[model samples]
Target: MNNAETLDRRALRKAAPVVGITEPGYADHSVEAGILKSIGAEVRLLRWEGKRDKLLDMLPELDVIMIRDLPLLDREAIAALPAGAGIVRYGVGVDNIDLDAARQRGIPVANVPDYGADVEVADHAAALTLALVRRVVSRARQVDNLKWNIAQQEPIYRIAGSTLGLVGFGKIARAYLARMRAFGVDDVLVYDPYVSDDYLAQYHARPASFAEICGKAQIISLHAPATAETRHLVNADTLALMNKRTCLINTSRGGLVDTDALAAALKDDKIFGAALDVLEQEPIGENCPLRGLPNVILTDHTGWYSEASVRSIQEKAALAACEILTTGVPTHWVNRW
Candidate 1:
């Protein structure tokens, strides 16, 4: 065919299949554009918030969706998509994605099961732990308001003397422990039956039972992922076991902690204040009860949002997206290939 005829034929044809993004605020480095040019593929960013009601409507014509929240493709949502489109989770945790639904539909779900992403969360956990113990946010606010009586506004609890209990001995938990050691904390206890003794000894972590970690430690930091067994792990009963002076810190998956029970405990002063970067809900609204409390240092679900870390996640995710779209082989499929 002549040049004009060839152009017309392709123009009448559908644009190549694209890789769509479910999350917003990623550094767009033309990786998608490059891949599309290399092999008749396109990449689009949807940037939609996946609430229960509107998730289905937000998804556009997609060959593949690279998602941060794994559970974005529930049975109802997945049913809304056309066949042959794949599902790819950009990050490690697949708790939010409906694996059974994807498996049933033969839609491959992928996740990069790596420690790199978890390290950012671990570092964030340490930051939140120290911020809570040192009352950094409240102190900053007091100074900003020109009422610089920090000691009166928010008391500084000594972390150096306190014991820090880690719930899970994963990569992030180990990172938090290293940060703690730097701060001169000698009492670091961990409660993960899965973590081997040699690794614990190497990290200078004392292996404690769950009850011991909750009861004896002055600060308890959650480092577990959101699994069926871990949902609301820190419920009313577990919260009751916590030291009255304990400060609960979580940078792990939100479902790991019970928001309702934690809110109640914070209200009643059953425990010291909490420092949380992850909540059961993302894009936590201003009206969220936790937002109204001064005792709780709540972040806007941005624990894993450092420039360096997010860049790495986006790069790998983009590559993974391209790989699936081009090769028909979903890299890092989380639901057992």
Candidate 2:
């Protein structure tokens, strides 16, 4: 090739914008690549294995980053990112990303908050609640072990006359309430300072404090975010307020519940049972206390997963990255400068 041709190719390569996927969990990057290609952007997979040094090394030269729950973009990581590089979280939570740090650095951060996961998340929460209340997992195991017709071994409760308590009144929480309402759970107490009592009344729900919800409801479900104030919202003190017939369900952030405190409560039969989708720690640690508890049902933080939801989040995240590259702004910008 001629020298001029080689120079022109090099210039074109440098001119093309680069978008990095911080953690590659999706099956393929076609959705991102296809969207980014219109703006001459190249999709680069970082495959960050939760390593600080490696992430720092690869931070330079990227115009945008798309991340999903790995190698937390904390203060240091946020500072390491190239100046003005936009960060897009694939899901609703930004707890892994330091929004304040990004704002300080003049880096805009966005999240795929409306990725259509409300239906899936609400459905999962209800399924877990039903499983826990009816001892579905335990009874299935009993039958598997050749112990049939053991209905008297475990007591079951009816959902027809139960009071439902919700920690947050977000989209997912409201969706869950609708499902529970169909099952005759009309009496509801919601604990969201952001939501007004009149608004709660529209849904036939009364606004209550966290303590009131914990103490009064027969079934308490956590739908709040994981923040400084909400961390360990379900601790020993809150669990103590729950009666023996109370059942707990958490499909939101795992950090909302204290793992050790919950295990201790279950061991002591403080509550009837509990079901969890997300945990404070991902891929649950080997020594995690909630591992072998039969009363507790656990899922691999997949409450927001479905083929359609996955596609929706991927498309939305890609569009966010595309906007940041082409327009220097995202539609759902959270941490704005």
Name the top TM-score candidate: 2
Q: How accurate is candidate 1 locally (lDDT)?
A: 0.73
Question: Please, what is the whole-model Cα lDDT of each candidate in the order they appear?
Answer: 0.73, 0.87
Estimate candidate 1's RMSD in Å: 6.4
The superposed Cα distance between candidate 2 and the true structure at residue 309, in angstroms, equals 0.4
In model 2, what are the clashing residue pairs, if there are any?
Answer: none
lDDT of 2: 0.87
Q: How high is each candidate's TM-score?
A: 0.85, 0.94
Residues 1-337, model 1: lDDT tens digits: 1223322433443567666666564567475457555667677667455465555665546667777653356778776654445676666777767777766555566776552766677778888888888877877877788975546444567778788899898777777888887888888898887888888888777889878888898889988878887889888898899755889998887888888888889898888889988889886866667777767998766777777776667667666666655554556866643
Cα TM-score of candidate 1: 0.85
Candidate 2 runs further than 4 Å off: 1-14
